[model samples]
Target: EEALRGLKMAMKADSPAKDTAAIVIEPVLGEGGFYAAPASFLKEIRKICDENGILMIADEVQSGFGRTGKMFAVEHSGVEPDIMTMAKSMADGMPISAIVGTDTVMDSSGPNSLGGTYTGSPTACAAALAVFDVFKEEDILGKSQRLGDKLRKRFDQWQEQFPHVDNVRNLGPMAAIELVTDKTSKEPRADFAAAVTKKAKENGLILLSCGMYGNTIRFLMPVTIEDNILEEGLAIVEQALKEIG
Candidate 1:
């Protein structure tokens, strides 16, 4: 929060960008790596934004639609945002995004002020509607939490067995294993991460790497993936790590 406050202050100092419209953030970062923002940090930012008349926007593009054991990642913090953005899993990759805000904030925008060519296309809307049905019929949120528990247990064991693995982070089933040269030094092993991802891909396990240093292997398994199939995919990852390193 202090770091964010410092940035806001610095931005306010600039005459041109002095307004500081909104502080947008990913509650649980996606491609940037799955570091779930601390609840306290989120709450503090909410307070800061409130004090400065700045909107707090939660970008839940990758962490929304039950991926993080909640409909939206910000819900975990219990801090309502003036504005919220969602995509990715919203329409199951139908290329649709949404920006919802409080009535007061939304009403402030003039008609035709917020829209795009594909904003409300029927195809994407149909997909998003179906997603809502599935969410109602299936226990996706609960399953996500259970999946996280299962993966975290194995990841913890892997950290103990693999010297290069450290900083295993997870929120629901959204998880990542940071590769480091040594636990004490925590020096990012980008090479190791790359090798593992390449090997996993070659072995038919579609894995991805993220983080600022590109040293973290992230998991984005489908919430609907069957338990047996999920284990099979994980076994491939375990094998890849064992063989690559």
Candidate 2:
């Protein structure tokens, strides 16, 4: 809901409204509570961009490579963007951001205009291609769906255990838990949120705190993490919540 609202706000921004090149967004708001934009919202955006002759770009940096239970989060909507960028977790975190777009949009420059990137050399490309091979061999995409199911189930268990937790919302592996002051404010327990995240880090758990107000802790567990390892991490999070008592 708010995700689409924010995009609308961005589109309405003065500079963008005056003269814009493109509209870029993560189909699933990764760090922003891992919220998945509804299909209707995506469809509307695509329609609007098409009508306005504006480019619609999907930033699949974090939600790419089976992270969202699919090879890409945008695939969930089946709506292709005019432009898209992807990188993270593609080459085992190797730095590479690719802009996939139509020739018309990308080949506007002349020769020698786009030839100064030695970062993703043959070695990195080979490594990245190899990762894709593994995805095919091991069916990483399927694993992502299964992993997300397990993760959500465990997260729900934790929410039940910690009644202060209002609920869990996620898109595949990307997930976030919203904490309430007492299950009533439904308005984020800011202090407790901080304490829990701090305690989790202290207990050897890496935590990413997010949400517009910084009152939510996001779990960006690697999709490659074994089931047991994810459970262990969950235990750490649970313990952290307990300590904040």
What local distance difference test score does each model get?
A: 0.87, 0.79
In model 1, which regions exceed 4 Å deviation?
A: 8-18
**TM-score for candidate 2:** 0.89
The C-alpha local distance difference test score for the whole of candidate 1 amounts to: 0.87
Task: For residues 1-245, write the lDDT of model 2, one tens digit per residue.
Answer: 68567766877775464477677878888667778888888888888788777888999988888888888899899898988877777787765666677888778768866643635487777778988999999888888888888878877887777766766877788788877766655777778788888888888888877777677888777777887888788888888877765
Off by over 4 Å in 2: 1-18, 115-120
> Considering every candidate listed, which one attains the maximal TM-score?
1
In terms of lDDT, the best-performing candidate is 1
lDDT of 1 by residue, 1-245 (tens): 57766766676676224367888989998888899999998998898788878889999888999988889989999999999988889998897999999999999999889986668689998999999888888877888888888989999998998888899979888899998988999999889999998888887888889999999999988888898999888888888778756
Residue 101, model 1, lDDT: 96
